[model samples]
Target chain A: MDALLIDPVLARACGSALAVILLLGAWQKLRDMAVFEAAVELYRLLPDRMVPLFARALPMLEAAAGAALLLESTRGIGLVLALVVLGISTGGVLINLLRGHTDIDCGCGGADGNTRLSWALPVRNAVLMLLAVAGAQAGLARPLVWVDFITVAGGTLALLGIYAAGNQLLANHPRLMQLRNGS
Target chain B: MNEALMISNALLWVAVLAALIGLFALARQIGVLYERVAPMGALMIDTGPKVGEPAPSFELPTLTGNARVRIGGAADKSTLLFFLSPTCPVCKKLLPILRSVNETERSWLRVVLASDGEQPEHLAFYEKADLKPFPYLLSQDLGIGFHVGKLPYAVLMDEQGRITAKGLVNSREQLESLFTAKELGVASVQDFIDHQHDHQRA
Candidate 1:
């Protein structure tokens, strides 16, 4: 299972997908700083004063990590940062879940901000982290030529679209349940 | 031979990429269908009184002095038991909508507001919201009895005081759904959908 997970194509696809998601998340946080701040506040993880500071700093860090992931030289550092960031945030969600604070907004950036903290979120983060780890196992077996770039681009785009659709489905599940049950 | 192998590899990659994109597009279509099917409304938690059963009976004092209101019995009028909290923002937002519903359905429906909290705080909230139209009662026991884990919940009882529908209502649509469910003689939206499916099959 472990060897199958770290295939070169899968690694490249996961890396690009993670990078795209992080960049988009960073851009969204930059667009609406206050909303992101409020979302961070909802977590109740950081002290009240530090909430503002963390909210302001998180987007920049994500952007840096995203940029590094795209560059061959900085890929390792980027993967590490991605791991740390994803790990901490997943931990935050886990803490809230254990504490029974599932009603709080996840503050995951962009259209997903309204999503409440739940088990699915931490699991999503865990999957993303796994992708990042696979991506970290760099040094491809074959030397990449011009043709490889096309393959990577196509693979990345495909993965990103699928990831977005999956997230949407996750967000829609609760509403579906409510509708089914007859609110 | 080497050149041919390289060309085939490139073609294979392109084909795989195209296939993946097609899969993604199909997933998007499924998402659109999911959105059309699923809607936002109150959630019916599988706890407390089940539908078609007698609502737990209770006598609680009205917010006003020296008056007691009866809940869950063979009352001639159907009852809309709205559970709210003074501190709940959603509950506050739903108050006006509840009032309008009460006004429109006054002849056949009796809307009651139930909460579990300090009397003075509730009185303050009632005054602030100008809640003179509905009977407001304070009872923690009632909330516990109903197994209300969330705020802004509503329960509909038929004229015979049996629970027709109840769920954790968050929006006006959700609140209305309870009535719609009861009117259709279904326990929930899912039940209604299933019944329709069965009818179609028949």
Candidate 2:
């Protein structure tokens, strides 16, 4: 296994470098207005039954994933974060292709300029996955602890609360309306 | 007084315990739904507001259509909404299918054919379908809020104005798969269409 075989110092170096690239990538994505718009478009395409709760939580996670990748202390944390980002991006596009709705762009990581599904996306991910595998091997994280589960459970619940409140706020306040209207 | 009251109190506690169990189950279901929706943002379509979202309240003044009707109001009934355009050809195919459903489903549901034209040609299409007396509302009031880009769009709402359904109501099976029932039937547009097809064949 790469974890057992790879040098920890080398792995850490690789992870730190990958983290910089990912953080820069995430920053670009965060800066692009259209990336956010694409996300909203995606939100619109979802079935009514599933929209409300997701519309809030996913964006926040993405924002965090980008931010955490740059920090040196969160080196191993960054790999896990990168896995989540790549896994969802690669998998979601493939699933959407299967679902028969292909008009929209994949919009992966500030990818507004890229129109077509190219070799770049999967290639980027494959490399990231390798880097993450190396770091994960070095870090040798244990299986999810009870504390981790509790944390995710608490986080998920907190996400739900935030969504509920945001929906209510968007409903009652016209400031959300202003955002909708390009203000 | 002491013994009889003690027995009554025990029964009360049992009832309370059962309610808590039911509520916990409901919370778990909500959690599961939350997990499903997260991270799949690009796939969701704009429904009148959104599905599971509280529908926006609006009533439009029409020159050709009948009186203004309130959408997303707690009218104490179920409503099937269509955010449609006169020029949309898909909507032309969808209307008859909906009318047939409206006829078969009866008074349990009301279809509101919402359109956003200040023109007469658009109103003429409504005259053609007749909508089985479905209330057609104009959308001059809230075009940006509704995100009226496409046609043949539809939504289902509860008595409380939260969307039960949205997007192109494609098939009876798809709707049935999406629908969940509790307490009373808010009715389903999917079942209504499928049964109507079944009835016509029968």
Candidate 3:
């Protein structure tokens, strides 16, 4: 466990990345509440009466977790909140996938809100959960330096870029398969 | 030595960040290219009025106005009958594209909106969609005549009432391909590709 501790700078970078992702997810959901509500209804996990309420509350929770993650004092609670949210979402995806309801939208909004349900989504969520866990670990305290700031900023941006590229690839996967089958 | 190492580390971080940004941009471009190339052309269902055949003519009433709209006949400009519905989201999305096409192709093309629905519902949709410029026709016979099974289908008819090309179009590029098919003298882009392959094989 001691050997698994992340460097403070790297941990900060991870937290910041997760925070930005959560905030963006919340913003996307809030931007189109109706669409998000429809997606939640499609999940079939919540009762019809609860769908709208859950849909409305999820983004608020995500925003709260994301804001909490930004502050060092509240990062622990934020990580827990993020993990719970990710777990529930992944569970919903897993249930739907198992049910063979792959036609519904994933609702992981970005440029690719229309991406269908697939195994890749759970894997993506797992990766995010790993980031949350890694971000939760405390690292050895070290004196701050200007170079450290550059590394942290650069690292976070790179992580975000990689995340975006991965999402684009995920979005393209089904279309590529369709093309391959000559459909 | 410590100072020099820090400088090199910072420089390496900057380079990595630049490389990641470049990678992301390349990925985005690839995504766009996939979208552009995926739908080779509007999906030709093969059940509709065949290309190069004369379309069944219809004198339908405009939904918004009292004027009668002629669907197929000898005309100066080509007619593009865009079959759409008030409830179909994809059809709604294509309205803006249809509007732009109407504007750009005004010289040689007359775009008409077609659907089968009740008067009050369609009239409300027409007003809300701001479709006053294009003649909106509510005719079930028109849809059946064309064998349109999908929402947001398009049929392009030349001045002589011949359907030059027609198919299920979901995007702007797919819609434009109907015009391209007309220009190429091919039934559809799929036919154009098959022709190319045959030529190469020969």
Candidate 4:
């Protein structure tokens, strides 16, 4: 039963779902830059050097992802990016949950003024992963969607740029010693 | 002792929970973890909670302050008892939001904050959050059945005062059902949702 609930299959499923959420999230974040912007502000919770880079690039990275997911050509590329995003985001949630930081909201909501923290957030991502897997399996036969390709690619780049800056900021901040382990 | 040694604050403890879950998650992938622990987990999870049976109750020690009580003792309104500690940053973050739940609903909740420290710390917490109006309790028992080993456990009771849900209450839709039932005298599940929708539209 425990195996049934928390099984390797579930973890894999979770990972896949994470992929969907992250890819989609990366795109939404690109357009709004709100949470990423807040996360950048949280850079002070990290270090000094990473802030400038994070604040400047995160929005663009998300925008790129939006492009990739929308474009049919880069669907595969976008899916890969989605998996990576979920891995990081899941790690963040687990880390916070364990460390007793439950108040923190999942950082996936887009730039719009939505303050949602529904159960759907996680489940939706999981479904997305299944779709990603389908998309991957059908990659060869799948038709093209240039808009998705452009959006996802764009979001990926935007996220990468922001993440780099964010990491650096955490590395520099002296007071945010807790972030030193880079959890 | 080892757990104590590693843990210093509520935030750190939550991080530990995540890390530990991650370990189990990773272990399941590797097969090393499951080969050893799956049997034990199955036994524990299966016999633990079920329907048509009265739910278990708990009296836990507050990990961050001075107060304690046993929740789910029969009452008029079904109680949605939750255990959280101030030292836990997660709990702290949730406090302000919970404080406001009463204005929307007619208060089917009796939030019992269980912590693991002295009165001063608890007092400090009350002052910090300005939660003087809420009921607080101390738990020396470490919130065993209330899910203190993991932090942030909640239990719900029906109007008949029977346990409807316990341990973790993350299912927003289901949890809301209990609240709706308590808020309105409506009995059925669909009725509550329909009424809620009407209320929303109205």
Candidate 5:
């Protein structure tokens, strides 16, 4: 563990990127609570009665976790919360995929709400989980420097760009398949 | 040596950032291309009267007044038969679009609203939606004649009373695609796409 410890700059960069992604997702859900609620209902993992409660609470939890991750003091709790949220979502998607119900909306906020469930979603969640874990790991005891700031900012922005690009690819996958099938 | 290493690291990080930005822009362009190339007109269900066939005629009474509405016949202008229901949320969402189409295309088109339900409910919806400009009618025979199995279906008829285009339309773009299909002399947008593909291959 000691040998594997990352620099504080790297950990901070990961945490910042995850924080931005979580905050943006939470904002999209909150923008249209009704649409999110409908998406949750379509998942059918939760009972009809619990759908509204879960829908309302999930975004609040996401926003809270994102805020906590921004501060070093609360990052541990934020990491745990993010893992739980991602676990629940990935599990829901996996269950539906196993049942061969791939036509349902992903409910994950994207360029549009029409993204369908597919294998890529679970893989995306796994990548995000890995980021959360890396971000949560304790850093080596080293003094901060001016150059570290530039590296951290650059790293975080790069991570966010990769994430956005991945999401666009995922969103386009179904459309690409449809086009290919000539439907 | 430490100063030299730090400078190199900073330069490499900047380079990586630039590359990531380029990748992101490339991905966004791919998304735009998909949107442009995807055939996104109103979905045409093949159960209804075929395009270019004479539309089944109907002379139903308007919901609000005693005026009789003639659906299919030789008219001075083209007719747009929009099938809707008061209970359909999408249909309600499209009322404003239909009104705008009525206003803009009034010169060459006549928009008529059709539905089959209780008169009182439709009358209430008709009043609430402020659809006084278009002629609203209720006729089960018209719906049965068209074999409409979906809400928010539409049929476009030319002045010769021939079915120019028909489909299940959900958005303003889909609604306009009916006119586009007619103008292009294609049976449907899917047909148009296939035609384009054939031309490219040839």
Candidate 6:
């Protein structure tokens, strides 16, 4: 079952998709460090002493991991770091959800950082982590071909478009609920 | 027979690729809908007075001394009631912006600053912030009436005292969104965008 799921071609496509998403997220944090810091503060999961340092370092770490994921030699280390980072963020979202702090920004970037926490966020992270693990475990089955590259490109674009759509829907959920409740 | 099989395989790949493109297009359409429906302007909590309803009336003492001010229910000017605090850094930052907004539309708009805190601290804020141009009212009752749970909140009321728009405003853009919503006769910017999208589709 595991071997069936960890197909090398699928793994490469997942790696590319995950790298693009993480790189975009990291770039947004780097673009506006202050906004990212404010979002971290809202989570209230980090100590005051650690918040500034973590805020400064997290984007750099994500960007490095994303870049490394695209390279053949560093792909292993990149997968490990991607899993760790995705786990930490999933933990953050899960903690905030449990605490009933639903209004804070997810800091995921894009759509003006307006994306709020929802059940979808942690689920999305979990899905990415699974993809990262599959990519890390994938073994070469055969030589590459032009058709294989085309498949990877199409698959990655499809995955990313769906991901973007999901994030936007999560952001819209609260407003739609409000509109429904007539408040 | 072999050539026919190869042609069939190529056709299958083309069909799959077309299906992927169709799925992607559908996802992008949903994204556009989300973008139009979500409130990117201001973070509005659900506890507040509902937009389009009459604002809860309050007669509170103004900081300018001796004269009590009445809010809500049929006024000469539309009210831009802002809830702020002396301690909130964001609220303090917004004072100048609010002052300019007050100055620019002095005729049709009545910008009233409301807060619930110690009198002396507010007095100091009033003096140091140079908020003499606006009516700064110190009233917990007004804040409670509006169900303002956060600092730097704003509510726009029409001349008939109907709540046009209200939300937790952080930036000047968000503050301006309130006015924009009012001008467009929508409850919020999200609604305005959705309305426009529906019109376009129609």
Q: Which one wins on DockQ? A: 3
Winner on DockQ (4 vs 5): 5
- Residue A135 in candidate 4, Cα distance off native in Å: 22
lDDT of each: 0.76, 0.52, 0.80, 0.46, 0.81, 0.77
lDDT of 3 by residue, B1-202 (tens): 9989988988887888888878777877876665555442222343657899999989988886679989887999999999987655457668888988888778779999998857897887788769988999988788878877555789999999999999888778899899878778866878878755654454
Of the true interface contacts, the fraction found in model 1 is 0.31
DockQ of each: 0.16, 0.03, 0.20, 0.03, 0.19, 0.13
Q: Pick the winner on DockQ between candidates 1 and 5.
A: 5
Report fnat for all candidates as fractions from 0 to 1: 0.31, 0.00, 0.39, 0.00, 0.39, 0.13
Q: How high a TM-score does candidate 2 get?
A: 0.35
- Total backbone collisions for each predicted model: 2, 13, 0, 77, 0, 0
Candidate 5 clash pair list: none
* Model 4 lDDT at residue A17: 33
Instruction: Tell me the lDDT of candidate 5.
Output: 0.81
Better of 1 and 4 by DockQ: 1
Better of 2 and 3 by lDDT: 3
* Alpha-carbon deviation at A165 in model 1, angstroms: 1.0
lDDT of 4 at B7: 42
lDDT of 3 by residue, A50-165 (tens): 98899899888888888888888998999989998888889999999999877666877845575778999999999999888777766677797887788778878888888887
Please provide TM-scores, in order, for all candidate models, with all chains considered together.
0.53, 0.35, 0.62, 0.39, 0.61, 0.60
Q: Candidate 3 docking: what grade?
A: incorrect
lDDT of 4 by residue, A1-183 (tens): 544433333333333333444455556655444335544332123354664465445434544544555455675676676555545454554555555544333445532221223333345456455544543432222344543343334343433333333323322222122233322
Task: Encode model 1's per-residue lDDT on A97-178: one tens digit a residue.
Answer: 9998776557785234435667888878888887777776774476667666776677787677667666666655655565
2 or 4, which is superior by lDDT? 2
Question: Tens-digit lDDT track for model 5 on A83-126?
Answer: 98889899999999999877666778865555778999999899
- Over the stretch B1-202, how does candidate 4's per-residue lDDT look in tens digits? 7556434433453554455555444433433322222221121121334422444566544434355545555665555565665533335445555665543444445654555546876777667567765656665442434333333555566655566655543234544554554446566778878867755654
lDDT of 1 at B38: 36
DockQ of 6: 0.13
By lDDT, who's the top model here? 5
Query: Which stretch of 10 consecutive residues in model 4 chain B shows the poorest summed lDDT?
Result: B37-46
* Cα lDDT for residue B76, candidate 2: 65
Every model's TM-score on chain B: 0.69, 0.58, 0.69, 0.56, 0.69, 0.69
Residue-pair clash count for candidate 3: 0
